[model samples]
Target: MGKVMLARRAAIAALLAMRRDDLFVVTGLGSTTWDVASLGESERDFYLWGAMGGAAMIGLGLALAQPRRRILVVTGDGEMLMGLGSLATIGIQRPKNLAIVVFDNGVYGETGMQPSHTQAGVDLLAVAAACGIGARLDVSDAQELHALAERLAHFGETLFARVHIAADDPPRVLPTRDGVALKRRFRRAIGIAS
Candidate 1:
């Protein structure tokens, strides 16, 4: 597996082991990283539009609505940068039930080749920490990720994990589903049917 996928898969497995039935996940296109890692019968996966940066906000809503439940947001670096302001809101809210994980592959993988904010020298963890969310960086192997997962279980703070995903082209798993169809499915997946 590629770097980003590897890290995400590890993280996903960790999330699954920690919480299965009482969790919420906000995920975008690049979430194929974690999707491939998810196991049988999980209704908690709230699929998101490629509407980059919206995932975290969605996670925030879920956390706020169900303040006692844990919410995890798996997003791409490109998408998070698109909605960086969401971090500020999350910071102010300080929802202890939320964790935001950004897979920093440094490219807008869904689109044609283009650099993301991370590639442009943006330290998202620093930016997030400045916004008041607890931030951490993961660059080591699977053991470190497992340890992080254990830590995630006990932290009652808004957490941000910036994972340095290896630079790889986005994976092709669902065949090239049309953009419109994908959006519709995503809306349904997240129960935002309109």
Candidate 2:
């Protein structure tokens, strides 16, 4: 598997092991990478449309409402940079249940090969820390990443993880469901309709 795929899988495995029914997963383009790693049944995985950074904001809402539940957000590096401000909101609230995993490909692969904030020295882990969230970086092999994921999972603090994945294109997966449909299903699963 590709580096991004490996990282996503490792992250998802860590998440699944911590399975809590109340937890929701807010994800974007790269979520499929993690989904492939997730076993059997999956949680509410929000497939972001063209909107970037949307997953993080949505995750914030879920975390706030269900303080006892964990909220895992799977997002791309480019997407997270788009709404870095949301980190501040999450930090101020100090929600212990929010965990954000950013698959940093160093480029906006989903929208063509454009450079990402990480390519420009935007240290996302540091940015998240500055925004008041506990953060860390994992750039080694899959084993190391899995270890880091374990450390972050039950930290009981808003955590941001920057995973340096090899920059590459993902295998084209068919969009079985559009954004609207996915949103509706996700909302129903999370007991939130809009």
Candidate 3:
């Protein structure tokens, strides 16, 4: 198969643009974090700087705790691969308001651009399906991405998608690194006692 046509920044911008006020976003470390912060910081956005493989689990926790709000977990293929078991856990938990979107550029963009398993033919969509996530998608074009964007707006089921983006690195857009402050801000935004 030929390579995917989507650009990482464009895809992320499109996705975040569709986010509603109640949407809770958790981004994985490295490129995905940068991609999210690039759209401007938000109290609803929790950017992971160190927990390399825990984004989805954190999203799951938030989804369970705040069942009424939509939760979106955005991460890169490399990070997702490191925490592959989270998929099965999420599949079992099956939060109706949770969605996970993987930016699969087929490389570990932060670690010297090493080729990832996605580049070696590991299909994440298939894994999600096998893990029992009912709503799974593999996005490679603008139309499909738009469709995914729409679904994210009114999410009602556990959703997973691996978006194939270009391998080129974009300028980093870093968020605040203070975990305590981020936690307090996120709690306040969600109306929880910090």
Candidate 4:
């Protein structure tokens, strides 16, 4: 059989379908941010607008601060490549509640679809494994995606996955752009008074 390339929106929808109330999400800028917004906005979602390579670090901080809640970072391959060092830091910190999912379409979706390192044969899952992330996965089909989605809710260790998605641009679904409002809402969602 030929390789299976998952659709970005469908993959994201499945992953979020089973999201629990305590799941905290940090979305990288561009496509990933759009994907999360498409699923429907929530106070638990922290959408990054300008921090190009900081999603994982933001997730790490959130994971550290709210140890009881599950932290998920969804980012595109370009963003993940930019913040590659964050993986090493996360590996060292070993936050059991943290998981990172990269939608690797092998291109910079926001930047005119230029081929990315993943397209050049860079394996992010391997890098994550090298950084000591124990639960590393490369999802290329629907069944694997479903299993990965299920694992998101109950993951016990720091996990990372690179999901191969189609390189098609979908309609952009935007969330609130006000930084203060987002911070306030997220803080309030986690039980912190603004």
Candidate 5:
């Protein structure tokens, strides 16, 4: 209820630390991608360089394709808002292995920190619930982050969480920009035999 919020980098670090080794990650364009790559680039990570609103859908496809592995989509509030319809589609498909986490700093970090829909008082958790997502988690602090991390490690159903973070710009950590190499690496990581 106050101005205090989680640090974006720290939140990503904590969540990734709790993530299971095989949990496939699909990061939205911009900040979230840098946040995850800041930790360390991984072949399991399919970082979206330009798909502004396709992270959740990609996660859904991955979940459906690999039912045995977990899929986590780490995206920003701006990207999530752009891909709002994907939530409904995900709900319809109901991939039990997929989870979406929105880092809500309340602004478009990729652009110029302009206020986003979430900053305009949109309740993303409610949106996800109304869209038929099975689990809704609102995380703002350390305890809640821990709880969410635990659930992510052993998730049993479709999950959507909004993590409130500070709208501060940390130094960007750029990863490989070669989409072709990234695609090949990710495919090999998932054992596509190519």
Candidate 6:
């Protein structure tokens, strides 16, 4: 049988349910942002409207600034591929509170579900390990997702996770697009006076 595929929306919702208020989230360009926004709006979520491939770096910055809080970067494979170089930089920085989770549906959902590099033999998990992020995980099923969510609370090392999700486009549920507002609210949530 083919490998089991996870529903992106469901998986994201499951993760967010376990989220601690202080755990800041930085979302990537399209669906990943929408997936998080769909549940509800929160000051802790810094949703990137059009910033493709920049999520990981943003998370790294937040992680460094708020060493006591966890920073999670949730992005898609296509977005991750665009910012592949950031992985190397992240490894060098090695922020213990930062974790990046790529929702690998193997397609660029924003551009109409075109097959992406991941579909053509790019192994993101290996790339992450190569970049020196020692803690790597491959989550394909519900069990793994649950484990990943649980692990999110306790990780103190730079961690990378690739979640295999189905290439199904759900309705676009967008978050606030004003970048300035996003920055202000996120800053306030993290205890920084904006």
- In order, the Cα lDDT scores of the candidates are 0.68, 0.68, 0.93, 0.92, 0.92, 0.92
What is the per-residue lDDT of model 2 for residues 1-194, given as tens digits with 9 covering 90 to 100? 24334444544565456555666777765544335334543436665555666778888887888787778787888888888888888778878888887877678876677887788888888888888775555544666676655655565777777767666554554443466776677778877657
lDDT for position 184 in model 4: 95
Per-residue lDDT over 1-194 for candidate 4, one digit per residue giving the tens place of the 0 to 100 score? 15767889998998888899889999998899999999999999999987999999999999999999999999999999999999999989989999999999999999889999989999899999999999888888988888998998899889898888999899999999999999999999999975
How high is each candidate's TM-score? 0.76, 0.78, 0.97, 0.97, 0.98, 0.98
Error of 3 at 134 (Å): 0.7
25 Cα displacement, candidate 1 (Å): 0.7
Cα lDDT of model 1 by residue, 1-194, tens digit: 23334545554565457664455666766554345334442445655545666888888887887777778887888878888899899889988889887777778777775887788889888989899876565644566666666756765778888766656553444332355664555446545648
* Candidate 2: segments with Cα more than 4 A from true spot: 1-22, 30-43, 135-139, 151-153, 191-194
Candidate 1 runs further than 4 Å off:
1-11, 14-17, 31-41, 135-137, 175-194
Runs in model 4 deviating more than 4 A are none
- Candidate 2 similarity to native, TM-score: 0.78
Which 10-residue window in model 5 sums to the lowest lDDT? 13-22
RMSD after Cα superposition, model 1:
4.8
Which ten-residue region of model 4 has the weakest summed lDDT? 1-10
Candidate 6 lDDT over residue span 22-134, tens digit each = 68999999999999999898899999988788999999988998999999999999999999999999999999999999999999999899999999989999999999999
- lDDT of model 2 at position 5: 44
Which ten contiguous residues of candidate 1 have the minimum total lDDT?
33-42
